[model samples]
Target: MDLTSNRQSWAVVGGGILGMTLALRLREQGKEVTLIEAARDIGGLASAWKIGNSVWDRYYHVTLMSDLHVRNILNDLELEDDMRWVETKTGFYTKGRLLSMSNSIEFLRFPPLNLVEKVRLGATIFYASKLKDWKKLESIGVCEWLTKLSGRSVFEKIWKPLLRAKLGENYQHASAAFIWSIIARMYAARRSGLKKEMFGYLPGGYRRFLQAFEKRLVDAGVTIQKGTCVQHVKRTGSVVKMDTADGFEREFDHIVFTTPAPAVSKACPGLQPREHGLLNGIRYQGIICPSLLLKKPLAGYYVTNITDDVPFTAVIDMTALIKPEEVNGNYLVYLPKYVDATDEAAFSRSDDDLKAEFWPALKRIHPHLTDDDLITFQVARARNVLALSTLNYSESLPPVHTSIPGVHVVNSAMICNGTLNVNETIQLAENAAVDFLKLDSRVAADVAGSRCAQAV
Candidate 1:
């Protein structure tokens, strides 16, 4: 499949992991690639910010042992030795107490559920993990399925609150496939010999990986245009043209939009009205996460699930998995709240407002945590962090190939059976690149045949 003689120019309109990976792959296949990023920096949702002279991820992220896609990327970058794996602990904040539920013994001893209810819950998890066809679960609501399998008592006390924390008010409308994917991922992490839940992180975090990847892209002759916002995309004859915010226009043989659905709709107005409506109708959930640098550790648990109603959804002690020495010997904790991305009020709230609202809730869990223990606090907002996995969500996803022949759409919203993570994003990018190249090869063959027929 050497495309050297039939090289096609491509424009990847997004700088996230998906866009970056796709552009790199296309370049490797002898295609002229130009990656356009609206943001000044790369990494998108996985972007990082400076913290007291050290850099860390803007949001909490970790690599599960089962994330083979991520591992492959690391290996390609020659960073396998940089990975550090650690067994992490999980905690449940309910009944006005923090309970450890990392292992089977602890789960059975949990106070919220009786023995029978706990048994049913365990069986539900095991059953869901073993399921191979997630499409079957798409028609069933998550709440209804969980209740039927784990009973109402366990559903309300455990599953409901956790679902609300992640999906907000849309949890009830979510499909059973949402929970099935989650259980499958967690189950795989514990299947090893030790059966411990282990997570891996690079010593310097994802920032290190992105830096290496960007360097490779440049060395491989991929054009990276940063801080360039694409306004609209149109197909003119056999080429795709992009209009940027700076009044500059560029043309390419093919265009791949790796942005969210809303951005995709905005950039490609030439799409049919029906196609536009479907893309616009897709909804997303946002996050307002505040990272706190503390002089002392607040909780030893890697993640504390809040079953109780609180200002924030979960308390994640990133240092529980990452050594404090990595970040200048300071503990890092993240308090995240998932909200509707369309809510103007939630997106407009100030960092001080979020701190004031979440401070008391933080104190409840760490009674000893005081203002003196906090070194600094920063807030990060991702307006379209996760796509809402509503029931039959797969049916609503726009096709990868749009009405415009050369234009394609691939984003987190297309992830029907799995959660949005780095690994899934990479997998989607790889698959989309393969599909695009195959289609391009067919088009080239057709053009060649037409020219020969006319000559004859």
Candidate 2:
């Protein structure tokens, strides 16, 4: 699908799905695209690695029926037809007991809240789903908004604990838009016939999709530079120059930085002080996710939300949604702990030390479990997994078009109205690609006009 008319070179300095999308989009616009990644392969957070005899996603991921952007990407990769969809249930660990909260009946029967509290909680979700002015939510604190809608008891017994799990103490700084975005997405799924709560996944997970996507990029004549760390990026004259840590330098007509805000700030020192400040203003939440391959399933529910004190945030039983045969008849579970990226204590604790804290909680949740059921245990850590949706987040975000002539910054921090997910990421890339091409055209026209004026 080469649309080459007047080819211009582009350098995308990140190989995640967002970067891959940008490269592919640029190439379709008749641009020579080069994707450079610091890691050995693409799929930054979505990458998979060996876990004993099987390979699966390092972090837990699921495709909701409402995630049209993700489905579109799968369609482009020709993997949409092979997707497997399954209905799964949800569980809640509260008040020293494990309970089912999947359907309206279970939710009404939930022991943590009385009848009135249950009604308020349900009403809160329904109201949030109908909200259209999410920007107004950014001005209000999450705690205040939830407390007002769900009442004090429901906020304390239910909402507070869940917020603490996902955002830690940083929930204090979050806006109402944060929770609204989440409810909107879930309701959107319900609108798509997921009232049964259906989730989908590819057979081989993202690894197979990434392999196919990489091959497609290659077929489209896009250059892939893997395992290359970009040290510095600057614009000189009409083009942007990038210096790699491996003693390699390359120049392109324009550069699009798809890295995190901090990394982009470090790589491009030529940006304005305001741009640097905006980049530094963004905060991120990190995750320490441990994948446990067990001989038997812990709970049949797909996701178990915990309100009780636990080392990890939630329990994700992958086998509940995916077939056990996918992982050689072994059940895969993810115990994820979300912490502030600056939390040195949580990040510094070793694998063995974490296991010491986590194993006890696992047994506490499932009292009948024993050590022999565990086949393998692996942990995955990331420093800046998702940007925090702080109050007025979008207002403080660095724009895609920077002060530098041929440089642009596009990252997850720019995701204002949506939660951090692959779907939102792909949509961001699509919008950024359009903006980039328009900026490129304007810059090129300006350069040509200047040359004509000089000749006259």
Query: How well is each residue in 1-456 modelled by candidate 2, as lDDT tens digits?
Result: 547674889999999989998898888888989999999989999999887689988888899988898899899889999999887899899877889888777887888888999999999999999999999999899999999999999999999999999999999999999999999987776633325687899999889889999999999889999999999999988899999999889999888999999999999899999999999889999999988888888778889999999989999999998889878899899999999998999888887888878877887988877898878777899988889888887799998878887788898888899998999999999998888778768878999999999999
Q: Give residue 75's error in model 1 in angstroms.
A: 0.5
Once fitted onto the true fold, the runs of candidate 2 whose alpha carbons sit more than 4 angstroms away are 191-194, 447-456
lDDT (10s digit) by residue, model 1, range 318-411: 9999999978999999999999989899989998888888876898888988888887778999887788888788998898999998899989
- Would you estimate the TM-scores of all the predictions? 0.98, 0.97
Q: What lDDT is reached at residue 30 by model 1?
A: 89
> Which TM-score value belongs to model 1?
0.98
Model 1 score (lDDT): 0.89
